[model samples]
Target: MEAKLYDGPMIDAHQHFWQPQINPHPWLAPDVLIPFRYGDYSAIKREYLPPDYLKDATPKHNVVATVYVDAEWDPKDPMGETKYIHTVAEKYGMPNAVVAQAWLHADDVEAVLKAQSQYPLVRSVRHKPAGALSPAEAQSGIRTLMSDEKWRQGYALLAKFGLNFDLQTPWWNLHEAKRLALDFPDTLIILNHTGLPYDRSAEGLKEWHKAMSLLSDIPNIVVKISGIGLPDKKWDINDNRWIVQETVQIFGTDRAMFASNFPVDSLCGDLETIFTGFKEAVKDYSPEDQHKLFFANAKKYYKMKI
Candidate 1:
């Protein structure tokens, strides 16, 4: 029951591209390593571009188009990643869509959003707000910054540019996320990594399920089913299957799509193994439903022409 056969071309709705060599990602720097929430992420500290991504994604999963989610790069040059992905998209014909980053609280937020919006492939923006509930979580260097007026002002700019939002935050904050979704009814909100149910305990998962259910009630919100192993870096098909099935059940095929999360998930297993687990998890669904989860939904959600 945990594994099922699924063969479909995927439109990877979520993934990332970063060149640590030319651009500085302080988190990815080798010597200054710290414990990340995802646990022992040192394995992915090197440069990863479309070529490397294609090498890992193709001949196995049949990734026709992928959407590049923002990788935390040097904060000083927020548009750098967009420029880099443009080159990759032009050369490889992959990453047909890009979700660039812009600090929602910055004084020049509009200027940044405008610059990012000018890029043809950019369809959304990702500026993960920090809203940790516990002192430990706060000390972990994660922020809980959603309610700020300045940030909301910046969030308002997305509608002006006609860009959607890629939201990556802890699950505890989904209630606030729901409010934001309501406030901007016209703006599309894509929730990253299955609400990031970082806690795998029975109680933790139960809490995660509750939060996701509440967020799913909002028509503007869509869930990206990936990062099942994030809270704990171990992988199990059955556990992942339950998360995948529960997400699709709650949001339905039209509102849910699968993403590789690639190098981040590469910490758990190879690309084939990761996507195979996803395919197997949804094997009982109809071919059309599987196509929606694996391909069509991403194309629609990301607004990718390919």
Candidate 2:
């Protein structure tokens, strides 16, 4: 049987746009190459504006809208990235929404969040909470963990301005996320990268599934099934189908949405290849459920007007 493609309009719940030349993305800087999950990312270190994104996404996928997440611009000036994206959107007419950057633990977090909230395009904020490298080190009382009172103080302000949170952390730390969601039941937490199941080992997937299941129990949290690309491995349907399907199973269609995580995931495959894998993985699902995963859920979760 031929697999059906999701031909409906898509709202890319998460992606990025950057011009390191104009704004300093220290991580993407030529001399400051940090370790990346997809190994060398020199190819994407250059400019990736809306045209480039459209070039990669269109003629293959009907990405009607997009939500631009922060591209790790200069932490010294968090608003710089947001301003740059605003300019990009004004000119390009894409990126219908945005997830701005603000360090939840920074002393100036309140100021940053307040400014970010005024932007019409800004829909949420992302501050990758610090986490333990392994489950063994997770008990060291990391001050930057979500449990940190100071961090929570800053996090509490999100509700004041009606901002959602985009959480990007490894699976093992989701225990903390579950608690955080419960503590702030009013705020919505969108978990990024499908809990980042990087370790494909049997025991590794077991732990990932356990964490996702536990986190799914929280009603306030939603999940974006993105950034599943593996290091040193091609983007293969056989490799990623279970991860995509299992995420929907854990979060259900209402709480889960598909995203490209593009240019970043482009390290593993083109946008077409990545979206095709997603479409193929869930071809058997009902059309209504497929619509939610590919489009409707993102529109609702991100509060996209389109």
Candidate 3:
């Protein structure tokens, strides 16, 4: 399915830029093995800066701005990752918003939030909670993260700092995500990677859909329609159309936005294919809705002035 170009001003709701030489990203270690959902990531193990990203994206996309979600760098120095991305934004004039990593359970949680919130570009924090999944449902990498009281306390601080929460969790944990959203009604929740429907079987899709429907009840929770390539590793536009449609149908255009999930998704295909695939998926929608998905919603959610 060849994708038609969408020549619209777009905002990559989610993406990353990392320099491994200067920063410690344990996940990028040669021996590290990501799950099949991410396919093979070796091609992206090298440094990926804004210039490299623009080289791939600008041909097909008019990306006026982007939101740099934290690449899982060394947890020891989360602020270092934020500082580096800020410099990248300064140089490249994109990635206008920064979602830094914040371990809600850290002993110095308040202090960490204070420092991160000090930066105007730091609009949110991407904290992949351990989750409250059962032993049977929990995968090898899943941890019991958000259920902790201390972490919940740390999450509370986000409101004080006027920061949103960028949540990346699997479908199995959306129920808990719903609980958190209701608990923090004041805090806006942005669900990453299409609720991370890692399971692709009929039953898996059913579960993901159900979880998404439940989460949709909370008006404050919004979805980022990206990373469908994770489970659907083949990257067929036809195959992705349903996921994109179902996502918009559930969250609606006002609460749903498009994302590149770049470099990581670059493993599946190029940035051109990713955005074209998205435009193809949503072609049936009205232009106003398409504009919201491509640009407006992200500006509102991340508060990107551009």
Model with the higher lDDT, candidate 1 or 3: 3
**Tens-digit per-residue lDDT, 49-158, candidate 2:** 88999899888789999999998888998998888899899999979999999999889999999999999999899998876877667756442359888899999999
lDDT of 1: 0.84
Candidate 1 C-alpha lDDT tens digits along 1-306: 443576778888888877676767788876767767667888787878788987997787888889998888778889888898899888878789999989999999999999999999999999988778653564575555556778988998899999999998877788778889898888899999998877778888898898789976788999899877754445778767778889999999899999988788888777887788888888888888899999999899888887
Tens-digit lDDT track of model 3 for 197-267: 76677988897898899976799899999988853365778777778899999999899999988888888
* Estimated TM-score for each candidate: 0.92, 0.97, 0.93
Candidate 3 residue pairs in clash (backbone atoms < 3 Å): 130-143, 130-145, 131-145
What TM-score does prediction 1 earn? Answer: 0.92
Among all windows of 10 consecutive residues in model 1, the one with the lowest summed lDDT is 134-143
| Model 1 CA deviation exceeding 4 Å by range | 1-4, 133-143, 230-233
Best-first order by lDDT: 2, 3, 1
Clashing pairs counted in every model: 5, 0, 3
| Candidate with best lDDT | 2
